[model samples]
Target: MRMTALSAVLALSVTAAAQSQPAAQALLDQGKWQEAASAGAALNTSAGLTLAAEATTAGASLVPDNQKKALFQKAQDYASAAIAKDRSNADAYFELARAQGRLAQFVGVFQSLGLAKDVKANLDKALELNPKMAGGYVALGLWNATLDSGGLKGAIAVQATGASRSNVAPNFEKAISLEPNTPIHRIEYANALLLQGKKAEAAAQLDKAVAMPAVTFWEKRDLEQAKATLAKLR
Candidate 1:
């Protein structure tokens, strides 16, 4: 009787953990980053940990540069934990890549360039696990574009990491095709174009991105960023 009762309690706990996921996501959708992170950290599952990582990384965007590296590292830790919980969680790998990209910004030239391997590997694994993940393609596009923007250093890094600007347009186009209505994809593509000094093309993409309807906090943030970037071009 005692064993059966304990098993029943364990099942209920598992069910509650699963049920808590959407609540955390609701906070994330509303841009309540801290709340979402806290809620996610309280749960034991990979999905919950992934949410915490996403929230931390997203929060890093709104912070000062001095503060961003720590947040990105925290997000990376959360993502790694999520992967430990479930290796097949595609989003965990994707979140790891995202955190790595942000963390790269806080390091020196060689260190930042070195991170390309980790970023690319996680992104590749994410896409391999879920071939149709548009965000993975968007990240790949950005990876190529950012690395190629480094001038001579970029060339060396490109050779070292095997990341080519040749891949940027195709990856971005794939992301745009997969998620045509996602403003972030358009905004990211414009960013890549700007890196290549294609001001006119960047402006066109920004125009389209700003005109799109934004339903989530992240989308709205991207829409505002697009507007700011376009204003600079004009």
Candidate 2:
């Protein structure tokens, strides 16, 4: 009887430990890498995988290949672990999408196309699990836009697919309406306006995003970049 009680306690403890790793991963998904690192510090391989996946997602947006490559490796490690833990875990798909996206950024445009497809597959699975996950939709849309696979045609494919400048503007607008405080959504809408050849309208949205009381410092930086781009257009 005592052995049975001890075994039950051990099982509960292991479950709790495993659960926290995924929780850390959730924080990472929302661009909270530091928080995720803190949450996952004492965990095992699965937890480390969560941390690595978050790191990869954060790294892919960078302009440097070295940085992107490192992050992709980290994300790959965690995503593999996650898949090992639960083959059907939808969140693992999101991590894999992030990893592939980072790796694609490091590779050339042609390679990026394949990575974009992987991102779509994982993101599609994620949405299947939770249709209301705004981030997943945004990520998928961004991936599709980047590859010019969704409404992308020719010379302007990069802008059309990634910025979803004209094609997915309404989606970002809808996402913003759903969550007013998220500055990234507004920025996406601003980009869409620019893609639609509405420079002035895009600038206005950027200004509004920059002025938002809830805007983060990073978001403000993105707004400034948008302003610079718009200035060149004007």
Q: What is the TM-score of each candidate against the true structure?
A: 0.93, 0.67
Those runs of model 2 whose alpha carbons end farther than 4 Å from true positions after fitting are: 11-42, 45-48, 59-64, 149-167, 192-197, 213-234
Q: lDDT tens string, model 1, 1-234?
A: 999999999999888887899999999999999999999988968999999999999998888888999999999999999999999999999999999999998899889877889999999999999999999999999999988886788888888888888899999999999989888998999999988999999999989889889988888888887898999999
Q: In model 1, which range of ten residues has the least summed lDDT?
A: 148-157
Task: Give the best candidate by lDDT.
Answer: 1
Model 2 collision count: 6
Residue 8 deviation, candidate 1, in Å?
Answer: 5.2
Give the number of the best model, judged by TM-score.
Answer: 1
Error of 1 at 114 (Å): 1.9
Q: Report model 2's TM-score to 2 decimal places.
A: 0.67
Q: What is the Å distance of residue 91 in model 2 from its true position?
A: 3.4
Taken over the whole model, the C-alpha lDDT of each candidate is 0.92, 0.64
